[model samples]
Target: MTRTTHDTHPVQGPEDVSGEATTSRWQQVRATGDAGLATAEYAVATVAAVGFAGLLIAILKSDEVRELLLGIIRGALSVG
Candidate 1:
């Protein structure tokens, strides 16, 4: 009796016809689900920055803060 051996490679499915495996529709969708994450973060940051600017404007419009800032500038300029 004689024994014989054979070399075999992995089987490629339909999706692997191009020599690379392709992602399924579900996988593609899952991968793209976070595509808008950066946009959403930017929008939130913009809104928060606008709110902060409004607050700063309201504070600077007050007479006390305006006078304090002006006095500081005058003192700094008057130094020799």
Candidate 2:
């Protein structure tokens, strides 16, 4: 048995309908990449701020919580 493939046309925009202009493919790719980078930067900043708030709450409420957090920081810095 043999299989057949079909070719499809891009969507017709206002200019395309009039046969006046066609869109570039590379521009679509660059726009998508830039949007992805912007979203990632926003996410990182949100997570760091939340972690700091958890540390602050522990400091205000529990001495044990404060000691555990201090140990985490000390471990990270290899200090007493």
Candidate 3:
């Protein structure tokens, strides 16, 4: 198989293509589907973060696991 210089590169650009339709950035941002989606995504993410934080606080405050880890770490760090 053989390749030519023309096949490897394109000289024409978007500006060279005339009369092609384009969408403005503000128009895309104003779409009905765009606005609500970000807020909905953010709400779900915020709820997950809060739930995870609550679970972590519960573990830190509990008696058995926290105490066990602390004792192990302290023993490993102890100097003779």
Q: What is the C-alpha RMSD of each candidate to the true structure, in Å?
A: 14.2, 12.4, 11.6
Model 2 regions more than 4 Å off: 1-37, 63-80
Worst 10 residues of 2 by lDDT: 1-10
Local lDDT at 9 for model 1: 22
Instruction: Report the error of model 1 at residue 79, Å.
Output: 4.1
TM-score winner, 1 or 3: 1
What are the models' TM-scores? 0.55, 0.34, 0.49
Best by lDDT: 1
The Cα local distance difference test for each model comes to 0.67, 0.59, 0.63
**Between prediction 1 and prediction 2, which has the larger TM-score?**
1
Instruction: Between candidates 2 and 3, name the one with more favorable TM-score.
Output: 3
Off by over 4 Å in 3: 1-37
Candidate 2 clashes: the total is 0
Clashes, model 3: 0
What C-alpha root-mean-square deviation, in Å, does candidate 3 show against the real structure? 11.6
